[model samples]
Target: MGNTDKFEMIANIYDTSERIQIAKASSDAIREYLVEANSKNAIDFGCGTGLVGMNLLNDFNSMLFLDTSQNMINQIKQKISDFNIQNADTLCFDFEKEGLSDLRADYIFMAQVLLHISDVELVLSKLFDVLNEGGHLLIVDFDKNEKVVSDIVHNGFNQAKLTDIMTKIGYRNIQSKTFYNGSKIFMGHDASMFILDSQK
Candidate 1:
């Protein structure tokens, strides 16, 4: 989960075509479940280079692009300046090391982020606390894949198991479904992605 240096090193070249396409798909999936978002604040949790958040600027009142890597945050800052986006800000914070400090949001979404966390339940609980009442948490990630194996990240996640974990964390009205499938999407193997929506 401590891949801060790894991400920082690639921050400049992270927005490749494949990643951009995935981010686009993720954002579209998130938009489907977003409700009354025009006047709400959002946090793009673990927002890498602001790919997903950038596409969602017009959907929310304000967006906070948050990442653990300063270089990643810098990349987003450059984008924010280049696009003249006024309602977006960047933050460099690590939830696993330091809990979200009074940072609350009406909506929080993470794309392909939960796979990297070592303690998923703890992080989910922290996010739950950070969300405002009646807010939503949207997660876009790879569905369970048995073909891929890795020590640094999970192969994928079982939707039912994840829902159970979120329910235990006090999230309600949980729902999930597969949305996108692509080649070499996860660990060089063809995989499908799912979007899960939960309310606080």
Candidate 2:
């Protein structure tokens, strides 16, 4: 089954306090590197249940919450309706199999989404195409953790290697730092989360 299928089953129960806390932290990290967000359109790529994107709605003029699972999109849509969020929208999309659409954004942020992508370079390239010139791409994901091996997801990522990959994909001004360290955060093992900021 695809990752979307796995996430579909958990969409209704995805917003536990732990996840909310993590999303808040990730949003805070992204906020630190943000520039002129109020004038920019942003995309919360792979946004699940709108946890992080919902918290960041006020920062951007408009926010697009994109995810692969329709159920997750439904959950986010419900939250949008319940909160009367006027500046946010939702799209159920899969970057892996789909060609680049007309979608474009001034800022693109992905929280804990890179680990699930099997072809990281392809997705990054597609995201690059989706970004407006000089747009920023912020990625929040776990640092390398050798102890946490899995078949469906990466153990974590090496910041330097990731920067190299992003650089190759044509992203500039790449900067990354570990911002949150939590116990049992990655595959039931202690892991540190890093935020990467890159410009297109």
Candidate 3:
């Protein structure tokens, strides 16, 4: 199967775990990075199944959830239905594409999505462009040393590479730390968090 096909096949399983306690904590950490933002508009890029949206629904006044896979967005639509979403919408978007040219947001978020695309710098540039001045970007994914995902399709990337990419992209005072808790992606026996937060 192709990359998207594989994700589509497994998307249901991902949505089913949306409210799990551990996942809630994981999502909370990422959301905390944005809660204090000056603006209420936020975009969750690569918002697969809207897990990030589910965690953040109560915080943002408006949110745009974007993903490349239509099936995954469908899964998110269903999964987030139970939440009290004040304002939320989903779109099929590839960040660097022309269609997203005018889509600027006060805050841009990406988690569990970067490793899928190899053009890390290009993707970051797109996110940077969409942010309002003084906006922030929060990212949570696997660190480079997490070898369990080495052979997996579109797994998290190395921590150092992320640091370099963010600095080169003109991000400021980037901060990152590893979270050693287990993750279902690694069969619940892996350290799953290395978070990065940067400014535009």
Residue lDDT tens for model 1, 1-200: 35788898999999999999999999999999988899999999999899999999999999999999999999999999998999999999999998767899999999999998899999999999999999999999999999999988988999999999999989999999999999998989999999999999
Ranked by lDDT, the better of candidates 1 and 2 is: 1
lDDT of 2: 0.93
Q: Which digits, one per residue and each the tens of the lDDT, describe model 2 over residues 66-122? A: 999999999999998998999998888889998767999999999999999999999
Question: Worst 10-residue stretch by lDDT in candidate 3?
Answer: 145-154
- List candidate 1 segments past 4 Å from native: none
Please provide the root mean square deviation of candidate 1 (C-alpha atoms, Å): 0.8
Give the per-residue lDDT of model 3 (tens digit) for 72-112.
88877775575545588888866545445688787777766
lDDT against the true structure, each candidate: 0.94, 0.93, 0.71
Q: Report how far residue 67 has shifted in candidate 1, in Å.
A: 0.4
Give candidate 3's root-mean-square deviation (CA, Å): 3.0
- In lDDT terms, which candidate is top? 1
Rank order (by lDDT, best first): 1, 2, 3
